[model samples]
Target: MKKINQLYTGFALAMMLLMSSCVKDLDQQPYVQETSASVYAKAENYKRVMAKVYASLAVGGQEKGDGNADLSGRAANAYLRIYFNLQELPTDEAVYTWGGGDALNPLQFITWNTTDEWSAAMYYRILYTVGLCNEFLRNATDEKISKFTPAEVAEIQAQRNDVRFIRAVAWSHALDLFGIPPFVTETDPVGAFFPRQIKRPDLFSYVESELKEVAAALPSRTQAEAGRASKGAAFALLAKLYLNAEVYTGTGKYSECVAAANEVIAQGYTLEDTYSKLFNADNDKRTNEIIFAIQQDGMNTTSWGGTTYLVCGPIVGSMNATERGVQSGWSSIRTTPQFVSLFTDVTGTTDRRARFHTDGQSLDINDVTLQTDGYGLTKFTNKTDAGGNGSNYAEGLVDTDFPMLRLADVYLMYAEAVLRGGTGGTATEALGYVNQIRTRAYAGSNAGNISQGDLNLNFILAERGRELFWECTRRTDLIRFGRFTGNTYLWQWKGGVKAGTTVNPRYNVFPIPAADRAANPNLEQNKDY
Candidate 1:
């Protein structure tokens, strides 16, 4: 149930929703015959289109390989891969060794500009997803619902809320990653004038309001599909948005963050006893802990993105492919020395979260471009919790579903919000939540926990790194603490320097892709791009 089988055969329908990708010229479009009249004549088409919306983030295209590349950067075009590259590669937690002709090179060194291809690709990809959601919502209106049976109408209404949740997700990422993104909604006509940009504060308000509205209509965690968004999923996203409210809108909403997190926490999700099991190929079985995950299946949702790259990218040097149960070692991604040092002992640590492979690698990374310069991470693998190979895994592809949000993260958020002066929780309770995470990480070791005094902003930040490494939250966490672009904290190879240097604060938000800005004059670039 967790795996989203590419349920639709009509790839053309998926491409039809991408208004930006339909034309050769950014500002121009060739007339097409497949209008909403033909595509949306039946109500069942709603779910098929919804599949495309989720698939946009799961696989790269209609087919696995080079042909029918749905978006640009083909292999790297998948939403989570580009999102991971932009979010994780540029941060201190991870680095890619591919320096030559790599589109992601700019991100790794923080030398990105408006012309960076990955940035543009991700921007288009997210907007394309939002467009599909808009298209679905537009077709499922009250006038259209009048024709369906009452039961069908009820199902369509529930599906409409699900589409709204997906839209809220894409918009939230856009707001977080691109500052104010070009705005569009179901109310906007399909082929009218171009959409104008919305500022960050306004975008934040939209995401907040949308989540609140949809959360009420969404199914409970138990009732929803494993990959589908639900009340828990909405609560998780709301918690994350409120956690970063200050960064997005210049307002502190830590209290709201705590309340939202508590909402999810009370929704009956518990931590997995084994920390390493969360990233195994069979992670879809760990649905109790995972609120929402981008579904991936080796046999069904095959792509170079998703957990396939996530598992293979970090396996380098002497990391045996057979031992990891994957076909090959991509050997692309590895941890920075700064990140490795966060653990008490890299080699022999009781912390199960310290999942680094040090067999032929050095702990210190003298050069960021060399693969073996830093320790490889074994956090994500094609093996299962029971040390068995994953079913249907082959040729570097995997069945690992990437956890978008988990219960542990919600717990951490609650504690952090409390420390930040949120009203709903006490420091003692916050410390208890932090200890729950540590108890899992430490396993059976005597490393019991810390007192209330140790639960400060700095400790919470470091704890987040330890727990959520490689999960694409590092950049946002660092930004909220004012450590992303300043001298307050430094990682290797930041700001294009071997020894990290302070970068311009303008980099806090990525520049809008040059092509997008050139196409829509109404879209203004972020300052100092």
Candidate 2:
């Protein structure tokens, strides 16, 4: 099994800290010197470089608590839960007041206020990661290390394709978050800069083309490189891109999503049969369901601070041996009643929907006991006590591997894409995929009945919420449907008190962090900042 500590080490921490520091310095660093003659001098050396590129995949800027305390918190207050609040702001779901520190907090009701620092940080992290991949590709040559024979050269090229695939992931992140980003190629000069935003459709086309090229070149499997990106991972990401193509480019790529998903499904991947097994740390690297996860190790040379559970873990009604003993000042995230209502009792006994309550008890909708007006999301529940060190108070250090893609995700993407493409697939046909996951949750057999015509975009969106709760895809899904700006329950409630009931378009994009604006004068702020 791959050790997470060895993969992330102090490097992840250094990268996170440095990303927040300075962007100009990134331009000043020299690329690793390489010549056509000396590149790829050793097969093992090239392998190590490839490994480093894989390692960079785990680096992320959003703190765990940032989502729970702010994004999820804001969303819960809006009467939507599971997906991030990015969707709630525009929908009738949420509203915000202009608090001082982050104007985007309040202005989320009115406009996109993303700052340059936020954009720059995301760009910096991705570019830095892409830089590592490019460095390996640059230095990988047949002559230098002389350690590789002809066969090894073929293998190295395949590894190089994996690096390219990772770079594509970074690019996708940029596109999804920023809409249009500058596409700097490997051949671009190290410090040369470009300041134009490409159109979203144009960027999506580029990403699609790149994934196809790399996926065709990637190996089907590699035992020695188990945690690295595989052909399946490439296909999964391609499927996701295609699934969202209509949203990103205003063009439906549902057929492409099906094709890409089918490719991964053909590779013998399947959903794990148990819901809890999917989250068990010990089963992480072993689960076939996980196509690509940010490999994490709680014990080892490259230790990551546990973040997900720490941030999203339930607050104690009262502290106990099993509960993290922190005072419950910020029980930030809660499930929406809408989401909780979706869970039906398999036994057909008394409805246990009240299990979702913050008070840890069920209540009938009409019962006065439902006064907390909160839904407890058990999906990220962490029962561990805060370690004696008190580090658990901060988020982003969770030991759980943040799953980026999984086999079940691919299956559902295919099912949804096929249904939306006007292809004749039954809810029964789709149920085959959905039931595999539902059965694992022991949530009873699939409803086993849905019609293609019945499979409206909203149905698929809700299905995604049911299956991928708290997986960080909520923001994208909401935006794609134009619901991010709608006034959902949370927005209606909060807006009623704060802004006296108004809708805002700027909430679609986050405000650029203020710190970034001070750093780059050329960086224009997202409108309403």
- What lDDT tens digits, residue by residue, belong to model 2 across residues 1-529? 3453444443433333323333346566654434423434546456555655665544332222222121121221211121133433333222222223333334333433443222334445565666777667666644433466878888777777877888888778767766655556666665656544466788788889989998887767443265667788889999999888887788888877877887888778866755544553444544478887766443321222122432334332322313332323233333334455455642223321123334543322222112233344444322232233122333223344556789878767877787786243445656577556555554444444354465656677766766776666766776666655555423323332332254464555554456544554555555654
State in Å the error of residue 382, model 1.
Answer: 1.2
TM-score of 2: 0.71
> Which digits, one per residue and each the tens of the lDDT, describe model 1 over residues 396-497?
678788899999999899999998889987788888888999988889554858888888999999999999998989989999999998788888888877
Cα error, candidate 1, residue 88 (Å) = 0.8
Best by the TM-score measure = 1
What candidate 2 gets wrong by more than 4 Å, as runs, is: 1-45, 59-112, 116-120, 141-155, 221-224, 301-331, 344-357, 360-373, 381-398, 422-428, 443-455, 488-503, 510-529
Native-referenced Cα lDDT, model 2 = 0.53
